[model samples]
Target chain A: MIEFDEVSYGYGGGPLLADVSLRLAAGSFHFLTGPSGAGKTTLLKLCYGELIASQGRVGLFGEDARSLGRDDIAMVRRRIGVVHQDCQFLDHLTVAENIGLPLTVSGRTATEEDLGELIHWVGLDGQRQSRPPELSGGERQRAALARAVVMSPDVILADEPTGNVDWDMSLRLLKLLVELNRMGKTVMIATHDLNLIRTAKQQVQARVLRIASHRVQLAGADL
Target chain B: MSRALAILQFLAGDAQADRVVPPTGFTARLTVFVSATMAFLTVFALALSLATGRLAENWSDALAQSATIRVSAPDGQVEDQVIAVMDVLATTPGVADARALTDDEQRALLEPWFGPDLPLDTLPVPRLIEVIETPEGFDAAGLRARLAGEAPGAVLDDHTRWREPLVRAADRLRTLGLVSILLIAATTGAMITLAANAALAANEQVIRVLRLVGARDAYIARAFVRRYTLRALAGALVGTLFGALAIWLMPEAEATGNFLTGLGFRGVEWLWPFTIPPLAALVAFMATRRAAFATLKERR
Candidate 1:
């Protein structure tokens, strides 16, 4: 339930995203497609209230993102999980600890059996005790996904979720996101891989939005 | 997610999670060293204040309940003046004890300057009477009037005027000691703030990762606070121990008839200096916490 109406963000030099109006309804799935440096990540950030629009308003959970204080933004973030392109993680933490980070930060505890089940579900059961620095790229992406969904957020915003993964591992990560969407979580993923987007369509109904000329538009491309 | 998984996740937000970003070991040593040195100085300042307080109290008490009645007359009249002064002291209700100084004792009072042998019969030196009083104290006006009427040259010295200045001097020393401690605490806060800022700046990437994983500002700050506070506490503890030992090791005081002899803690008063470590830790916590929350706010 994120909405961007006439939202434009820009660095001090000039507008990177100009006059972009978009709405993400509840329980929907979308893939943001664009070439490198096309402001795709920036748009995804606005959706999650990470970077507020410099020129226009981005609303998260129906509140103007720019008007919210840091604490309010944190509350918004707690409801919208984010997975970065780099699979950002506390590297000093073990893979299992990294995956369960969201819950830990919120002061909630997890049982060994529950963590074991989640780790096995992500195909990271063998690497649960390994630190993020020790995990392979595919494991890192899956760990990031586990962290994102661990909060049971209403929305999952992922920027280049499978960018560092092998083809098969990419498919697995995509399937995980799709499964989350099927469970009634709204998902938006920024990716340059068209085949992965097409692969996602076979399992779930997902819209593809392309960013160009500082505006968001429904892509003519389909799976 | 299950409650167990959530708990594990939150615990991961500790400083150990960001251990991948190395703290400048030299800086840690520098901070701990600096804080320890500051704490050491603070301990001395505290000791000075406490010692001066005791000195002032002792000086004030010693002077408060005593006075001197000096008799200056011809050699033969010395006995007559002393007897007249004793009569005057006897009539004073609050006078506890009055004794005439023996010739040897009186000569010893001037021995520091005049040496051991003094021909007092040839000299017109005044005869001194040592007078002690109860807590309520004798009426100075009544004794002085009687002395003036009988022993015209006898004068009563309550020692109040000189004692007031001595007490005030000690009071000023105590105030200076207190001010020094406050300054030391301020310095510690400043140094810790800088160190915290530096650490936060160095670990920008660590913070980003933590935030990406849904770590709150409060969670991030707790990690730093716990680290810095513990460092300050430990450093201060070592500093205090060294400082107290240094103070205790000072050579035993010599009787120079000077009030500075008791310028160190006595007996159970030694426990006061130990409080500085906790105080230092508290200061570190507040300083680093402020820097962290401010930095995180700017990051957002």
Candidate 2:
């Protein structure tokens, strides 16, 4: 339930994303496609209240994003799961610890069985105790996904979830996301990968939004 | 009171929360070393202040209830004036006791300056009478008037002029020692803050990861704060122990009864040094919390 109405963001030089208005309704899956430096990450950031809109209002969960205090932002973030492109992880933490981080930070405790099931679902059962630096790229992405969903958030915003993986690994990650969506969780993924988008269409109903000319437009069937 | 309980709750942290941030070696050691050094110095400052306070009180009490009389008359009349001063002191209502100082006693008082070989008989030094006062000291003005009437050459020296300056100097030294301890605490806080900032900077990626997972700034700050506080506590405990040992081993003041020799804790005062570690921990907790929150906000 994130809405951006006529939101414009920019660095000091000029506008990077201009007059972008979009609404992500509950129980929906989305794919954001654009060229490099096209503000895909910026849109995700605004949606999560990491970056406030410069010209227009960005609302998260029916509240204005700009007005949320730091603690409020943290609470809102607990309802939104974000998987970064680089699959950021604490290098010193084991894969299991990283996956359980969201729950830990929120003052919630995940039982061993639940965490074990999640790790097994991500196919990281064998690497449970392995640190982030020792994991493969695909393993890192899956670990990041596991961490993002550990809190059972209402919305999932993923930026280039499969960018660093091979086609098979990408499809496997997409399958996990599709499974998550089938369970009624809203998911929005930003990427430039067309093949992955085509593959995702076969598994689930997903709307494709393309960022071009500093604005977001609904992509046609040709994509 | 509620705030202190909240701090205690934070200190009793979850194992999972503490595991989020990786252990940093250099900053940890730096904080411990700074805390230890500052704590050691703080113990000395506390000792100095306490010792000076005792010295001031002792000097004030010893000088307050006593007065002296100097009989500066011609040689033939000196003995008569001394006898008259003694007789007048005997009738003084609040006078505890009064005795004329023997030549040997006068010589012993001046031995440090005049040397042991000086001939007291050949000197024109005034005859001195030591006066001890009762709990309710004698009225000096009344005694001076009586002495002038009966023995004009006898001068009442109540020792106020000499005592006041010594007490004031000791009091000032005590105040300066307290100020030094405060400055040291402030410096300890500053150094710990700098070290925390460096640790936070080095762990930027760790912070980013934690934030992405919905960790509040307070939660993140608690991780760092708890760590620094414990390190400071441990280091300060060791430092205080060594400092107390050093002070304990110093030569006993009973041998000299000199001010320098008495610059240490006495009786119940020995418990004072034990407070330093907890104080150091508190300083570290506040400093690290401030630094962590500031750094987190800045990065955001």
Fnat per model, in the order shown: 0.40, 0.85
Evaluate all candidate structures by whole-model CA lDDT and list the values in order. Answer: 0.84, 0.92
Docking quality tier of candidate 2? high
Candidate 1 displacement at residue B116 in angstroms: 3.5
lDDT of 2 by residue, B127-181 (tens): 9999999999988899999999999999999999999999999999999999999
Residue B4, model 2: lDDT of 93
lDDT of 1 by residue, A1-223 (tens): 8998898888777898999998899999999988898899899888766798887778899999999887777778889989888877766667887777667666666557657777887888889999888888888888888878877899999999889889999998988898889899999999999999888888899999998887889998554
- In terms of lDDT, the poorest run of 10 residues in model 1 chain A is A105-114
Candidate 1 DockQ vs. native = 0.40
Could you say which candidate leads in lDDT? 2
DockQ of every candidate structure: 0.40, 0.86
What fraction of native interface contacts does model 1 preserve? 0.40
Error of 1 at A12 (Å): 2.2
Tens digits of per-residue lDDT for model 1 on B216-235? 78878887777787788889
TM for chain B in all models? Answer: 0.91, 0.91
